[model samples]
Target: MRVTRRRPEWRVTAIARDTYALEQKSPYAQCVDYLLVGRDRAAVIDTGLASRGALRSVVTALTDRPVDVWLTHGHADHIGHAGEFGAAYLHEADRPVQAAHSDPAFLKRLLREEMGAALAAVARPVVRRVTAIPPADYRWFGDDQVFDLGGREVTVVPVPGHTPGSVCYLDQATGGLFTGDSCCDWGVLLHLEFCLPPAVYLESARRLLGLQRAGAFRFNWPGHHGFPAAADLPEQYAACAESIADGSGVVRPRRHHAVVRYRDVLITLPRTYLAQPVGRR
Candidate 1:
């Protein structure tokens, strides 16, 4: 169901007027990248794994316009194939995270801890292929930075929590917020060493909820696992982060980590972090 004879590597869906969803298929890794096409040029949200083949060709296949890559965050899965591109932008805060996650051995071991050892071993080849290092000299952009793709424009909303530089891109034309690895239906990962405090994520969640309520964007386009996230997903996560911040959230074990789950949404964090006061943390 993931593929057909015509397209083997990706499943393309026109999620918005000029926006397309390029999803990697075959094993269905669920890594989704968004391509926004404009009259003069194009903007790609993230480059997916190299195992799917050259991402530049994929974007060109959709639009022949000149393209610039914008990263939602610097995590390994989201920043895939950045080195192959001519121009890629990332937040300065996640510079360390980008360097650390670029190592294949480190990523392999971390994958083993996150996904079982057997699965990690199975995915080793793809992981190795995906360890394409992003450019060290990146054009850094902070919150409120806008990338103008001719008629289309994407504004960066700094929602740093999953990573210090994590962000969501808002497409002004379509009201589609491309949430790259921030809080999603699956989870928000603040348990990692490089992640910011849970309180930071809580504030971000509240802000995103406010934006949604204020009709800043109609829906959330998640980075992984699913396509369009539920309308209330941000609200649910805001509640979850609030509970975790106030020390009222429930914690349970998952494989090798602990998470505060709200229905299907998960916020992974450590006990030490959970114990700290919101302000101190």
Candidate 2:
């Protein structure tokens, strides 16, 4: 995993966590951590792979400002190791989803059936090493909520699509945007969670674009695909929506052709991943 540093005292570290597939193959999504340095307190946005302790070690390296863990969404890849932190915060709307994710058995089943058995192996350590973070400790973030972290103020921008209650953190001090999973591969593929329809997801993407237009932010960092330095994300999203509306986005071999019609806009398993088995299941 490569660790890249951002401008103005913020560093983004990509972890080496891989998920197992049903065919027992390993696939990596390049999870990221956004570490912010403030005069009073420091904050970490999104903890990567719980079992690996990536988030924990990163905090230890930075200043001991009262660390707060902020979740872009409650997807296992983003918040799987949330319990490891003293207290974490996420959008209140995703509370139920987070609750479901905290369940070991459910996660096990999810990996075994949906994701793949190979991923289950990697997930096991994360599940077993689970440290339960209290629900009360987590505060619900609203749209345009600003957290005053001493010298730095990280603004919470709600971009729900990939998941309900998904959020992104904007650091005004650095003009850096922490995009959960909304912008990937240069805003090509926008993955929608089951809770959100494809159309709704497009709307959320537009909201983020508006923020960028306002000129408060410039850089884009996602939960899985690392960082993107583009200013035309709004345009990309519009194109994605257009492909969905039209019939040009579909590809062969995959079943959800209509939903993921745009080759550039859909987030699907890479050929390297789908071709390989997840494990010895």
The residue-by-residue lDDT of candidate 2 on 31-111, one tens digit each, is 666667678776667765444334455466655667777888787667755655667889888887677677787677766
Best by TM-score: 1
Which ranges of candidate 1 are over 4 A from the true structure? 1-7, 26-28, 131-137, 271-281
- Give candidates' CA RMSD values in order: 3.2, 9.6
- The lowest-lDDT stretch of 10 consecutive residues in candidate 2 is 16-25
lDDT comparing candidate 2 with the true structure: 0.59
Model 2 misplaced stretches (Cα beyond 4 Å): 1-29, 52-54, 117-120, 131-136, 186-194, 229-234, 245-263, 267-281
lDDT of 1 by residue, 1-281 (tens): 68746556767889989899988764525688899898888878877655657677777888888788888888877777777665788988888887777777777777777778557655677565765444433678777688888878788889989999998998889999999888567788888868787888989998889889889999799888677988888988999998887777776666666789887788998656535565565
> What's the residue-level lDDT of 172 in candidate 1?
80
**Against the unseen true structure, what C-alpha lDDT does each candidate score?**
0.79, 0.59
State the TM-score for model 1.
0.90
